[model samples]
Target: MTTRKDYTRPLDIKHGRVDMGHGAGGRAAAQLIEEVFVKAFDNPYLRQGNDGAALAIPAGHRLVMATDAHVVSPLFFPGGDVGCLSVHGTINDVAMCGARPLYLTASFILEEGFPLAELKRIVDSMAAAAREAGVPVVTGDTKVVEKGKGDGVFISTTGLGVVPQGVDVGGANARPGDVILLSGTIGDHGVAVLSKRESLEFETTIASDTAALHTLVAAMLEAAPGGVRVLRDPTRGGLATTLNEIARQSGVGMLLDEAAIPVLPQVDAACELLGLDPLYVANEGKLVAVCAPEATEVVLAAMRAHPRGAAAVRIGSVTEDPHHFVQMATRFGGRRVVDWLSGEQLPRIC
Candidate 1:
């Protein structure tokens, strides 16, 4: 339990830096959580001042939970920071299950000497993201590590939601006759983050495509219930790796039309200069949907109607192949295997 002892002085949020005392589980810790976290993520369950949140799930729905860690470098990126990324990443994970996200729990590992202003900025971003997504951060844990022993700050978040009955979405649900749909252009997030790095340079700026996707998902389910068989957000390894995973899991293969897969011209140019395959790049706000052939047009239409998926297109179709290979028909009329990323292409990219 936290002891709310009256303090005579307020924390200097402007010029103050975090110290070991903030995570000591005493007055300093209490004050930090009360003034900062509580102020931003003010909600009934969180204001209860409990170690865990008490939540109620919708009746007749199955529970869904997903967690993710945010350690992207630069902390702040063109379109998002580690804060919103932490919230969006976990929320997307839960939403991918065809669930309605309800609550979130956050855990922070703060490096001693990290600036209080930066911390507050991140927390505020997280709070805003939760509010916009209609989810609340009801509980969380905070810890401090010795300087140089940890990054400025690392965040891990878990989201909980309820999936209505009759909805089934997963990697293993993909079938040989399924049609593949991509949410939008690829490589935007990866290129945006990489452009911020000291080693890379770009003439034209690209922003990360980070956004909450649950609403778009809801629209699809509402439009064609039981039509979507598999849904995945191509994050770390981008389109190729994610598709390969789905193919292997479903004991099937995939054939992609390179010309149909959308890629922004600037992003394509940047990848060409860097010798990076856009297919293997990372994307934060995009998703891939595999639906039954009969429902492809309906689902595609639904996706295009949503703001997050306005660029949705049919990229390929699942096929029967014992090897479970993901091959793409190139614009040059030749086909090649779209294999898993051979090694780390970009590091510290979430």
Candidate 2:
């Protein structure tokens, strides 16, 4: 066998483009992973340099896992890019299950001829987000597709968490008398991406509310251990669709106060201008929670105390309806059924 020679120069991160060799599982592949991924997402588990991470799950705790794929167009947006969004998206999914997010795994699909500078920027952003959230990317895979066969980049992330004993949260746990709570204003994310994508200008800029919510979930769970019944992050389908899903699952109905649901003035305006409904728009950092009526005050207080949920409010309640519909009492003294969004409202929105 012949000995392999070391590279004479480092990767041209500033002016290079990814080639097929970077994903060939040879010298180029090893070099790319070592310089880009391993250097940025440095951690004990990742430093092991193994095919998979060996995580030590906490004793007596239940395990939870969630995965999300981000394909948002124009990779870069007003407030965030696909990088941080991928991390926040997966972490929020795990948190919505009432678990404490512990670790993350990232996978990248790079198109041939993609600029190395953009790739490095995205990786750095993902690293910063993971550090801020106290979670680390442990293991990941990289693949390259032929030019014109794929987009610039696509990221897929998976999060692993552990739920403490005595906590049970699920969509089916909602009851007829439970109260529904929203974390903050909706439609900010969808509008932010839309404005950037369509070049629609507004007096004020709309930014994506991409963030990790495990800490907020922890706070609410601590405040009412067994009182919280359901937790969900409204992503693709927005608030109305999410509520409809829960209503169907629990065999109940929801009655919402249109006035109580918070919507930023700019977001509402942007929706009106674009012929869109804010209720059908997406939100990245917001959450919908259902808790027993007796625990409403405590849960609301706890949610408001957290920065992520500072604007939390009681928006509605579960009701008995054989039709399992989600109805909203309009601020104008009329009621309307918040039906499921008809066709894809906004495609590739995370």
Candidate 3:
């Protein structure tokens, strides 16, 4: 005979709608938690009903915190959705400071009348991503907006990390002659999301490279201690905007070899068809590293060894030009100025 525990049919997750009861502090909310959040993100800390989580910190390391909000249109996209992107985006932000991400706090703004099934899918994805990255969402808040006032859902994540002593990395640290390295192909994330948005079918599907890159950064730092000058993830404004920010912050110039930059042919073709500049496209799973020239090879080797950076390449170098300009040498043997993006090309991309 099936006991009540065994007969609890998972809260009707398939066809149920998210009514106001889901956000109410009542049995309905508890049922949602028990069936969805608890099931997806099982952990000792979360199981405790305290208002906050208790964690132990390691000695000699300073904690780093970073937060990001995700309001990307079309919650579901190729290779990732808003759920996984939320986790990776904040994790990457914390890791860009050369820290080891430890914990995450998430907030959800949900729309009433949304499908419980979809919400569960997104939450499951977020839980899976956090688990895979070895981070836990220790605390979270959920609020429901009237049906039309909000998108399907919006997620904001705050990440906590530990930065080791004597390791410094920032946009202001790029020095002249530092080699610039790209983790892998550019424009993949942006194009992937764009394709899904426009329903633009392609011969070969392009998937977003949405991933947490802290481990890759750790490996690179270990291989070339003190040689890593700066690190930045090219997300919103893409490589051009990110490089320009670094150049202006460090008061240096950059010269990128266009041929050395990697872009999938489908992405390039899509960009051409859409009149979009790949330089200004967005990326979720790539990093731009500015390292000492002597350490470039070692850093590249280290990056290639990581699953997140298997296609790492040396793409450019910092220069001493006074204008803090970023220029690219095209494959046609001509150079063109790569300036900061004038306006948002693809807004709400992250």
lDDT of each: 0.91, 0.92, 0.90
1-350 per-residue lDDT for model 3 (tens digits) = 31122223457778887766677656666787778887888888788756788877898788899999999878999999999999999999999998999999888888988898999999999999999999999877777777898988999999999987667888899999999999999999999999899899998999999999989989988998788989999999999999999999999999999999999999999999888999999999999999999999999999999998999999999999899999999999999999999998988788
Top candidate when judged by TM-score against the true structure: 2
lDDT of 1 by residue, 257-296 (tens): 9999999999999899888899999998999999999999
- Tens digits of per-residue lDDT for model 2, 121-203: 99999999999999999999999998998899899999999997778999988999999999999999999998999988999
The better candidate by lDDT, 1 or 2, is 2
| Model 1 / residue 9 / CA error / Å | 2.2
Best-performing candidate as measured by lDDT: 2
TM-score of 1: 0.96
- Candidates in descending lDDT order: 2, 1, 3
**Model 3: which residue pairs collide?**
none
Stronger candidate by lDDT (2 vs 3): 2
TM-scores, all candidates, are: 0.96, 0.97, 0.95
Cα error of candidate 3 at position 32, Å: 2.0
